[model samples]
Structures are given as C-alpha cells and as structure tokens.
Target: MQQIFDFKALVKYRDRAAQRLGTVTPVLEELTDRLLDRLDDTTSRFSTALDFGGRGVLAPMLKARGISVDSADFSALLAAKAGGTPLPLPGPADFKLTQARYDLIVAPLSLHGLDDLPGALIQFRRALKPEGLLLASLPVLGTLHELRLNLLETEETLTGKVSPRISPFPELRDCAGLLQRAGFTHPVADIEELEFLYANPLALLHELRDAGEGNALCARSRAIPPRALFPAALAAMPRKEGRMVARLRMAVLTGWAS
Candidate 1:
C-alpha cells in the first residue's frame, strides 16, 4: 500500500514537541475528556483497558476510575510522557494486537492519520474480548476547512496551482461503515463541531504545529510556501469579534466487539 503520511516524521515531531512544550492540545484534551465521560456513563466495568494512540490521556483517567490501563503509541517520547509502554504503531499494516487482550480500547484523535483505517478497526475488534467496547475520536472531513480553503485559494492565486496542505479526514458515515465492516455491533458515529478563536491566522497555524498536527501527506509540498501566502490567507479568513476563527469537526465513534 502506498504511504499517505510520513508516520515516522509525525512521531518524531510529536515527541520533540512534547519534550519542549509539555502541553496537550486544548481541543484534543477536551475531546478525550468527552470520550471519557461517555465511558463513565457505561454500566459495564472494564477490568483491562488499552489507551491506543491516546498519547497517555486515557490511561491515567482509566486508572483513576479503577480500571487497569495500558497505553500504546508510536512516539516513545509521548509514551514515556504518558507513562505507557512504547509501541511503534505506524499503521494498521504494522499492528500486532494480541487476541482478546483488552476489555476496552480507546483511541483519541489518532485514527485519522492511519493509512488503513478499516484494517486498524478490524485489529481493534480482534484485540477486544467478546462484548468489549471500542471508542475512537477522529477529526472529521470538515476539520480546518477554512484553513484548507484559504491556503488553496492563496496558492492558486499566487502560483496558479494548489498543493496539498492538509490531511484528508474521514466522514462520519464512513466511520460508521468502518465499524460495521470491522464486525463491531451497534456502531455509532457522532459529530462534535468546535470553533476556536485565534488572534490571527498565524496563531492558528502555530496552534496546529504545537498540537503536532502538521501536514504529513506524501504529496504535500516540500518547498516552503511563498512568504505572501500566509498573510494573504490570513487577510482572507473570516473574522469574528475581531479574531480569526477556525472550526474543527470531530467524529466520535463507538461500537461493541462481537
């Protein structure tokens, strides 16, 4: 399969950022909290849980809830930060999940980067015990739409062509289908749209960088974008209350391992 993302580079970038900043993305943290809240409402008690690609957020929360939690991530630095076992989980093709190891598996803001999402979902299903729960939060298709549009229009106006500047995310219905394809029962996918205000477009870009959410597409432009591109894009962005606004639509998916 063709590699769509520079997964290793992503891991290295995230690790370095974590080492330097020691901060979590605000939106991601919020999303994780929401997912955990849903888990809390569940009547089923999970004895063993896997915080898959959660960057350590879910594990400690699960532990606090008296569930035995283990975490896995592609970035060793992130894993260490989360106090988890380091696992180089680049994609579904590299998955080596042990059968029926977890009663609950949760992945927060991680599945959108996978090259083989369906395969990953299948692996999650296989790794879970019967009636086990699977929950995942992924950026939906409309995430960063404004940024994508502004960048594309700016590039097209300047260079007469556009380059890939954002990662393509899955749609909500597609996520539901993936869960069903993975043989999970009672699949559910819901969207949560979040709007954030930034001082300027540069701030928004910086936030994405700080969150380790840079462009990782194989087809992404290697050359630096023109200096005027950003300013122009910023000027073009819609302002609300004197601040630039960015929107992110996150898809939360849940299912039961049958």
Candidate 2:
C-alpha cells in the first residue's frame, strides 16, 4: 500500500482523555474471551503480549497475567500512564518492537482508526513470532448501522446531504483478505452484534464522547459542530416508544504469523 499522508489527531484526542478509554472494555472483553477460547493453548509458548490499542483496560489485564505487554496507543499520555512505550508513527510503524518482544498482540475495536490499514496489518504480522497470534476486534462495515442510517436521514433532512462524517469500516470478507495479504495464516473472522438502548440521542452522544469515541474524519477541522445540526441529527435516530436504539457490529479476527 502507498504511504498515508501525515495526519495526527488521535494522538492528542486520546492523550487528554485516557480515563474514558476504559468504557469499551465490556465489549472488548467479550470478544477477547472468544479469541482466547479459540486459541490452541493458552499455556503455550505465548509468553509475551502486545496490546496495540491498549489505553487503559487491556494493559492492566495483561500485566495481571504476569506477561510483559508492550502497550501501543496514539496517546502519549495513555502510554505513559500504562507504563508503555509510544509507537513512533501515527498509523503504522515499519520497525520491530523490542520492548519485551510480543508473541500475542491484542487490538480490540481499533483497526478502523488507521489511515493505512493494510500497512498496519503487515506491521503487526511482523511484530510477532512465527507461531504468534493476533487477536483483533474491529468495527466493520455493518457496525453502527442504525447510527449511520440515522445520520443519513438527518443529513438529508437538515443539509440535503446523505453521508456521514465517519468513513465506512472495512467489510468482513475484505478484512480477512487483508489479513491474509499481510501474511497471516489460518485467518478466521466472526461478528457479534451489540444493541444498546438509550433514553435519547443526546444521551447516546454523551456516552460516545465520554468514552472518548468520535468521528475519525481526518479532513475535518477542529471547529465544533454547528448547534442546529444537533436536533435534526437526533430526530433522524431510530426511536421506538420514545426510546432510541443503536446497534454496534463488532468483528473479531484471529490469525497466526506465517
């Protein structure tokens, strides 16, 4: 893949909000359990661990297991607090990691945030041993379908635009193919759908912000969203009996180094 243009927003975004990073752990841990269950053996020579998107939660878990985990995050603040070394690049680094060299890497619900996903996958593949495993969970194409639909509806109603601020996530088949292309073997991918009920659209938005999750539109400026867009956006949401609902599709991929 061609190199991505230099862009660095998530670093500052995540750095100042490390505390909110733990909110997604319930969803991530669910996927993590499935990945671990599928592993051939937990006691195998997988002595070292790497948490690629590790900010607050996964880092602690790996440490508790007595494994030396090299935590990587865009947030320098998070890396410092978690006792991790920061990744040198914004999206993907071509160098190998020597901070306790990892045999298993866990990146949950974060791959879509990259600018050069294919290149990043290759980097992760190279960071592992021949028998090492990568347990990755990502928000795929169908993720947040309800939210996307709502955004489209709101766009049409308010601005006559039918698109959203966030990019569409990678399709499941495409993700598996990308992993294979990145040189992983026995690649397996699966999906788990999560439905969250909210009292209102504002509540849902608050939750997302509180969790430090937001649109990753790289080209968008730092200006605040217009006030008029708020209500229209909320009105476009899926409401049943005065309650709004959102669906999150989480995809998990497991592969071994070739």
Candidate 3:
C-alpha cells in the first residue's frame, strides 16, 4: 500500500547496471547457480519458465536444459537484453500475465525492492499452471548489516542525523508466510550465508554500484552526504586475514502454485 521505492530511479539504476554488467557479475552468477541448484532438487518437469529480474544468467542455463525461457525485469532494457522481451516492471496490482501459462517462475535477487512483495507473489502465483513452482532468491535481514551499522554510526557521529542509506530487506521467517498468504502450497524458505574477502571496503562499494545496487528508497537522502562519511565508515569495518569481510545472506523461497 505504501510506495517505498522510486521506480524511475530503480529503472535508471537497473539500466546502468545492465549496460555495465554485460553478463559478468559474479554475485549475480553465484545467486543464479544457487537457485538452479535448488531447482535440481525437485522432480517436477517444466517446459516453460519466466525468469523475473534475470540478468541474462538464469535463462541461458534453463534453455540449455531444453526449457523455454522468457525474461522480465524492472528495466525494459535489461528485460530485453537479458531475456529478449522488453517487459517493464509491473506494479503489484498491474502485474498481468496469461493465467496458467508457465510451469515455473524464477526470480533472482530482485524481490526485496518491491513495495508490495506479497501482492507481487500473488500475481506470480496466479500466472503459473496448477502445481507450477515459484522460486526466488532475495537478500534477507542482516545482509550487509555491518555496513549499514557502520554507515549509520559514522553519519550520526558526524552530523547528529541519519537518513536511510541502505535498503531494508525481508526477514527470513516472513518469507514463507508471504507465499502462504499468496495461496501457495507447501511453501518453504531457507537461507545461505556467504562470506567474501574484499580487497578493501571500497571495493565492496564499487561492486555494489557496478551491480546497480544503488539506493532507490523514496525516503533516501537526496543531498550529498558528508565527504568523510564513507571513508570513516569503511575505515571502521572489521578485517579478516588483512581483507575486508563482507557477508551476504540470501533467502531462497519456494512454493507450488496449486
């Protein structure tokens, strides 16, 4: 019901990421592989799939398995470039697809930004055939928590005020509940926590930018932050083996349409 994201900004950042990424984002590839690995755990056979918010990674793998794939994203450019269809991101109420059209729908690392995640999930469920599956990967609470904490502490220490700098993510326990609320059957949610050694904290920031993980919160601070904010924050990060350790927690959600 509340619009928390700036869709225009989301699309702009996504397009920039799409152009810059060009199918070579290690993080995206990692998540896609993980999602597919879960797919292998199932015995269901799918002839068609919709790769939602795909970055040109998941569809190819599915195609190789003889499954027809259609791609969609919040960015039309990305939707076309990745999946060959120029579908724009749909609002919760506006997401329309042929009923019972696809046997599988895969959404990777894209659900966290939606203002109406439950509504979107319902729409996704509606577009699937009976007994079809919906699989999605999204960042959960505590993902990038260290960075968020450091940034907030540094900013508050410097300016005595704080505004949202990082986006909020869904909690792990609530993911499956969302599916159930959307009328999914046998909904399940699990998580994988991955730690990466970054050359430095700045490298993490750069990768996020390159990945188009920019802040799109409608309430985000528009004014440029203090010049020393990032430096101060990054300097405060914990180190592991002389490198900055960044932890990413991705939640995998699964449900059957029927």
Candidate 4:
C-alpha cells in the first residue's frame, strides 16, 4: 500500500517535542476527560483499562478513578515520560496482544494519523476481553479547514502549484463503517466542533508544532514554503473580536468487542 504519512518521523518529532515541551496538549487532556465521563455515564466501572496513544494524559486519569491502567504510546520518549510501554507502528500483521485482557481501551486524539486505522481497530478488538469497550477520539474531516484552505491558496499563489501540507483526516460519516468493518459491534460515532482564537497565524503554527502535529504527509513539499505564505494565511483567517479563529472537528467513536 502507498504510504500516506511519515509515521516514523512523526514519532520522532513527537518524542522530541514531548521532551522539550513537557506535555502541552490541552486538547488531548480535555478529550481524555470527556472519554472518561462517557465511560462513567454508560458503565459503572472498568477494572482494567488500556490508555492507547494517549502519550501520558489518560493513564493518570484512569488511575485516579480507581481503574488499573496500562499506557502505551508510539513515541519512546513519550512512553518513558508516561512510565508506560511503547507500541510499534502498525504493519501488515496485528500487534502482539498482552496476556491480560483489558476491560476498556481508550485512544484520545491519536487514531486519525494511523495509516491502517481498520487494522489498528482490529488489534484493539483482539486485545480486549469479550464485550470490552473501545473509545477513541480523532480529528475528523473539516479539522483545520481554514488553515488547510489558506495554505493551499497561499502556496498555489506563491509557487504556482500546491503540495499536500495537512494530513488527511477520516470523515465522521465513515467512522461507524470503519468500526463495523473492523469487526467491532455496536459502533457509535459523534462529532464535536471547536473553534480556537489565535493572536496571529504564527501562533497557530507554533501551537501545532508544539503539539507534535506539524505536517507529516509523505507527499508534502520538500522545499520550504514561502515566508509570505504564513502572513497571508494569517490574514485570511476569519477574525472575531479582532482575533483570528481556526476551526477543528473531532470524531469520537465507541464500540464493543464481541
């Protein structure tokens, strides 16, 4: 299969950023809380849980709630920081399952970057005990639409062509289908739209970098984008109360293992 993301590079960058930035993704933190709240409302309690791709946020939260949580992350640095295990990138074969099965598995703000999301979901299902719950939040279609459009327009105008700058995200409409295809039962998907205000476009770009969400597209441009593009994109953002606003949409998915 053709590669869509440079996942290895992504892991490296994220690990380094974690070491330097010291766990700064408030969005992930908020999403983790939301997932836990959902679990609380639906189920009484989970005895054992796995925090997948949380990088460090969900494990502590689960433990605080009296759940036995084991954390796993794609970045070695992040894993070390979280005092958890490291997960290898998804490949043709499924990940090796642990001897102990989990009652719940939660992945927050992480699944969207996977090249083989279906395969990962299958692995998640197999790793869980029967009827165990899976909850995941991923940035879906329409995430950063403003930034994507601005980049496209500015790059095209400056270079006479455009290259992929933002990674493609899964559509909310397709989330349930993917879960079903992965053999997950009782799949449910919902979307949450969020808007953030930044002082300028450079602030937005800096936030993305600090969050380890910089461009990771395999087909992304090798040459540096024109400096003018940044200001142009910033200027193009919708201004509300004199602050530039960017939009993001997150798809939260839930399923049960049979």
Clashing residue pairs for model 1: none
Ranked by lDDT, top first: 3, 1, 4, 2
Which lDDT tens digits does candidate 1 get at residues 1-258? 778988876776677666543345555567789887778667998888888876656667778878877677777666666645555555447577789999999898877777888888999999999999999888988888877898899999999999888899877788899999999999999988888887756877776776677777878888988999988987887789988888889888999998
Q: Which lDDT tens digits does candidate 2 get at residues 18-122?
A: 766455556546655655554444445566887776555666676766777777766656766554445533444543455225788888666776677877778
TM-scores for candidates 1 onward, in order: 0.93, 0.83, 0.96, 0.92
What are the per-residue Cα lDDT tens digits for candidate 4 across 44-138? 46888877767677778877778887677677666566534455434324556673399898888877667888988888888888888989988
State which candidate has the highest lDDT: 3
Distance from true location, Cα of 191 in model 3, Å: 0.8
lDDT, candidate 2, residue 78? 70
Model 3 residue runs over 4 Å out of place are 84-86, 90-92
lDDT by residue for model 3 (1-258), tens: 788988778878888988777534666787799988988898999998998888878788788888988887877778887753446666535667778999999998888778989888988998999999999999999898988999999999999999888899889999999999999999999999998787767888878877778999999999999999998998887789988888889999999998
Please rank every candidate by TM-score, starting with the best. 3, 1, 4, 2
Candidate 2 local accuracy as lDDT? Answer: 0.67
Every candidate's lDDT:
0.80, 0.67, 0.85, 0.78
**Where does candidate 2 stray beyond 4 Å?**
1-6, 22-45, 83-96, 161-163, 221-224, 239-242
Between candidates 1 and 3, name the one with more favorable lDDT.
Answer: 3
Counting clashing residue pairs in each candidate, in order, gives 0, 0, 0, 0
List the pairs of residues colliding in candidate 3: none
